[model samples]
Target: MSVFVASLAFGVISASVLAIASIGFTLQFAVTNVLNLAYAAVMTASAYVAYEVNQAGVVVWVSALVGAAVGATMSYLLNRVVYTPFQRRKASPITLVIVSLGMTLIIEFGTQAFVGGTNVSYTMANGPTLGVGSFVFTGAELGIVAVAVATMVAVHVLIRYTRLGKAMRAAAANRDLARVCGIRTARVVTVTWILSGAVCGLAGVVFGMNAGSFGATSTDIFVVLILAAVFLGGPGEPYGAMVGALVIGLGTEVSAAFIQPDYKDVIAFVILLVMLVARPTGLLGART
Candidate 1:
């Protein structure tokens, strides 16, 4: 029972980080209608930025801030310079996905060329571990979870309360209608990119802190897992993403307790497949 509890806590912690990353990815997809394959590269890029900031004697939170800034900026730039132009040319969904894949490869290879193909660690500014029942977590881990929950709440509030958020939803629902409604669809799209980027960066930093260290491949795999969670939860459903990520995180960790740790990934993926088979639209997605 203790082991079970331990696994459950671990799963929640994992879900927390995954939620941040997937939320960003899902938000971008919701607004832009593109499943960005290059998102992992952005996460890795932000993690490296955080590492460099920490190495320069900045605090961990400061590093995270810097990372978030980079992510937000990068996403804006990508949209302004690449996607926007492609969109102007009336790119199709498949074309956007392919373009994102190309972007992903370029970013990954660029990182490898610049940073070298190697793993790096960002040790959590060492602190005491807190335990609840059989679950153990460090101050840094809890901080990560807090940040995720806070970000999600913030997003919910923004969408529910703010004018800008309403504009974003309008654009997502129907770009032409949003434009007709004078919602500034282009600007909203830009804001969506920036917001998505910042969360992605935060996700990268928090996950790096939580897991100790990672290389490009590790981060990329994590991004893929996040995408799966987002898809399972329903791409445009923010709260649904949280639920799906939590389910995947728990399923993976608990399964790992009895099976080879390596198979844990397979378990999460299998669940995603099963979910897709049962409901093609996703747990909370529209049937469109």
Candidate 2:
């Protein structure tokens, strides 16, 4: 029972990270209709940026901010330089997916070459351990959960109350119609990428912190879990992505406590497969 509880605690941490990453992934798709296989690559690059900053003796939190900024910049450039050109040419969705996959390879390998293809860890302390009954967490882990909660709240307010959020939603629903209705859809898409990229960057840093180490290829597998959460909740549905992240995070962690740890990712894959077969539209996704 104690072990179960401990696993649940770990699951919450995992879910927090997944929620951040999955929401960013879903938002990019919702606004731009881009699957962005390179999203995880962006995460990896941002983390490495943070790692460099930390090595320079900057605080980890401050380094994370720098990473987020880099992520936003990189995302904006990718959209402007790569995606926008293809979009102007009316590229097919599959073609864009292939392009993103190619970009993923380029970014991952490029970073690997630069970082020497070895595992690296942040130079930050986990701080004091805190326990509540059967649940235990370090200061850093708690901080991660707090950050996730704050991010979710901020996202809710952005989507529910802000003018930019409304415009984003409008553009996502029907870009042509929104443009006809006088919304600057291109601007909205650009802003969406920037916002989502920031979140993606933070998630990458948090993921590395939780794992204790990371490399260019580390997030490649983690991307699968993010996809599972996004699809389980519903593609392009932010709220649904959060729910899916929680489910997958908890499911994988608890299963790991009982089964082999090596199969944790397998558990996520099985859940994703089941969800796909059972309800392709996802939990909150409207049927097309």
Candidate 3:
């Protein structure tokens, strides 16, 4: 029972990270209709950016914020310089997906060339351990959960109460109609990428903190879990992503505890496959 509880605790932590990344991914898809396979690449790049700042004697948390900024900038450029141009030419969705894959190879290899193939851990302490009931967490782990909660609340407010939120929803629903209705859809799409990228960057930092080390390819495999969460909650649905994250996080950790740790990712992949077959639209995704 203690072991199960411990796994559950870890699951919550993993879910927190997954939620941040998956939400960003879903938002991008919702607004831009782009299935960006390079999202993980952006995350890896942002984490490396944070690593550089941290190595320069800056605090890790502050360095993470810097990473978020870099992520926003990179995502903006990706859309403006690459994706936007292709979109203007009326590129097919599959072509865009391939392009994103190409970008993923480029970014991942570029980072590897710069950082080498060595795995590097952050130069930060986890601080004191805290226990709640049967669950134990370090200060850094608790901080991650707090950050996830705050991000979720902020996202809720952004989507529910803000003018930008409304415009984003309008654009997602019907870009042409939203444009006809005088919403600057292009601007909304740009903002979506920036906001999502910021979240993606933070998620990458937290992910490294959780694992205690990372490499250029760290986020590459993690993207599978992100996709599982996103698709399980229904692609393009932010709220669904959250639910999916919780489910997948708990499921994978608990399974890892009872089964082979090496197969944890396989568990998530199985769930994703089952979900796709059972309901391709996902739990919250509306049927067309």
Candidate 4:
């Protein structure tokens, strides 16, 4: 019973981080139709930024904000400079995917060159642990959960109620139709990039904090899990992403009870594979 409870608590924490990252990823696919292989690189870059900021004696929350800013800036520039030009030239989706893959390689090597092969950790003091029923989490872990919930809620509100959100939905549905309706599709795309980028950056920092130590490859490996959740939840659907994250997070953590801890990540991949074979559109995604 205690083991089950602990696993559940850890599952929630994993789900929280995965939700943030997957939401950002799916949002980009929703608005821009780009798979963005460079997303992992952006996450790593943002995590590094947070590390540097924390080293400067800044608060973790503030460092996270800076990391988010860096992500937003990097995403915006990538869209404006690389993806946009290719899009303007009417590049095929495959070509864009290939381009993004190349970009990922560059960013990964660049990061490696800059940060070297050293594993770095956040300089954080341990916080008080709080237990609810059988589940226990530290103040920091609870804070992470809170932040994830707030971010997800904010995204939901933006997409469901606001005029800009309606525009984004229309654009996602059909860019030509949205532009025909004078919805300013370009502006909507830019906003999408910024929002997704911020979420990605924030996710990266929180992930590092939770893990205790991370290196450049951390986000690269994490990106696979994020992609799995994004696809499983249904690409372009924020709510679906959250649901998928919950399942993946819980499934992986709980699997540790029966299987070797080293196989935890494999569980996510298996779930993803099953989802792909059974329902390509995802659990909540409507078939196009």
Candidate 5:
């Protein structure tokens, strides 16, 4: 029972992080129609920024903000300087993907060079543990969960209530139409980059802080987590990403509890495959 409950808690925390990062990824995909493999590098990059900012007595929230700022700036610059030129040249999808892959290599190794190959941790521990049901967790877990939830809610309210959010949705759904309607799509895309970058970076930093030490490689396969959840939930569907994350997180943990702990990470792929087989659109994803 302890293991079961603990797994549940672990799963929720994992889902929270996954949800936050994947939402950003999905947003980028939705607006640009790009499958940027370099997204994970953005994660490493932002987390490293937070690491540097920590010297100034920065807390998680500030670290998150800094990480997000770096992410947003980098994302926007990449789009403007790299992606935009290539896109205007009518680059093939495969070529764009390759470019992103190249960017990934550059960012990853760059982080290793800049931040060192050594693993680094932000906060040794988060907050105090609280017993909820049969599970327990450090304050970091709770804080991360709260952050994820708040971010999601804020996103939801923005989308549902604000004119800006509606314009963003319109741009994502049909960019050509949006541009025709005077949406100033370039500006909208700029904001999307910032929002998504921040979310991804902040999530990476928080995740690293919670788990202790992490390195650039730690940011690598995590792209799979974000992609799986984002695609599973439906690309660009914020609520769907949240659901997909919870499912994947819980499934990974439960599988580990029942099967081999060593294979915990494998569970994500299994679920991804199963979901693809059942509903190619993903649980919450719309057909592109």
Candidate 6:
């Protein structure tokens, strides 16, 4: 029972991190119409930035913020430098996807060049564990959950109540229509990249925190799960992504209590396959 409950607790934490990363991924795809394979690379780069900041004696939270800044900047630059140029040339979505894959390789190798393919640990101070019944969490884990929830709420409010949010939705639904409606789609796209990239960085930091250590390929490996959640929830649906993350996160961890730990990722892959076969549009995704 304790093991089960512990798995549940860990699942919730994993879900939160997954939610953060998945949301960013969905947002990028929604607004840009590009399946950004490089998003994982962006996360890894941000993790390294956070590591360097932490090594410089900065607090963990502050380092995470710095990582977010770096992510935002990198995302924006990539759009302007790589994506935009190709877009101007009327590149197909498939072409864009291929380009993103190329970017992923470049970023991954670039990270390897600088970090030397070695694992690095963050200097985080441990705190007391908090438990309720059989479930337990550390201070950092609780903080990750809190931040994830807060970020979700903020995103919801922005989308539902703000002008920019509406523009984002409009842009996502139909970019040409949004422009015809007098929306500055260019500006909207820029903001989407920045916001999504910020979340990407935050997720990367929390992911590293949860794992205690990471390497250049750490985020790339995790991207498989993130991609599963994104596809499971609906590619461009943020709320759907959240639900999918929760389901995948809990399912993977809880299943481990009965099966081998190494098979956990297999569960996510199976779920993703089932979802695809049952409903390719996803549980909460809208058909275009």
lDDT of each: 0.85, 0.91, 0.90, 0.90, 0.82, 0.90
Report the C-alpha lDDT of model 4 over 1-288, residue by residue, as the tens digit. 478778988899999999999999999999999999899888888989999999999988899999999999989998999999999999999999999999888877888899998889888765788888867678889888998999899989999999988998999999999999999999999999998999988988998998888888778778888888998989888888999999999999999978999999999989988987898889889976
Error of 4 at 100 (Å): 1.3
Candidate 1 residue spans exceeding 4 A from truth:
none
Instruction: Name every residue pair that clashes in candidate 6.
Output: none
Instruction: Write the residue-wise lDDT of candidate 6 on 85-190 in tens digits.
Output: 9999999999999999999989988998999978998898867788867666788888889888988898899888999999999999999999999999999999
Residue runs of model 5 more than 4 Å from their true location after superposition? none
Top-scoring candidate (lDDT): 2
Model 6 ranges off by over 4 Å: none
- Model 3, residue 40: distance off in Å is 0.5
Candidate 2 wrong stretches, greater than 4 Å: none
Give all candidate RMSDs, comma-separated: 1.4, 1.1, 1.2, 1.2, 1.6, 1.2
* Model 1 root mean square deviation, Cα atoms: 1.4
What lDDT score goes with residue 182 in model 2? 97
List where candidate 3 sits over 4 angstroms from the true fold.
none
What value does the lDDT take at residue 68 in candidate 4? Answer: 96
| Candidate 6 displacement at residue 288 in angstroms | 7.2
TM-score of candidate 1 to 2 decimals: 0.96
Report the C-alpha lDDT of model 1 over 96-168, residue by residue, as the tens digit.
8899888888877887787788888874565778877666788887888889889899989988899988888
lDDT of 6: 0.90
Tens-digit lDDT string for candidate 2 (72-150): 8889998999999999999999999999999999999999999987899998888888988867689999988887888
TM value for model 2 = 0.97
In model 2, state the lDDT of residue 281.
93
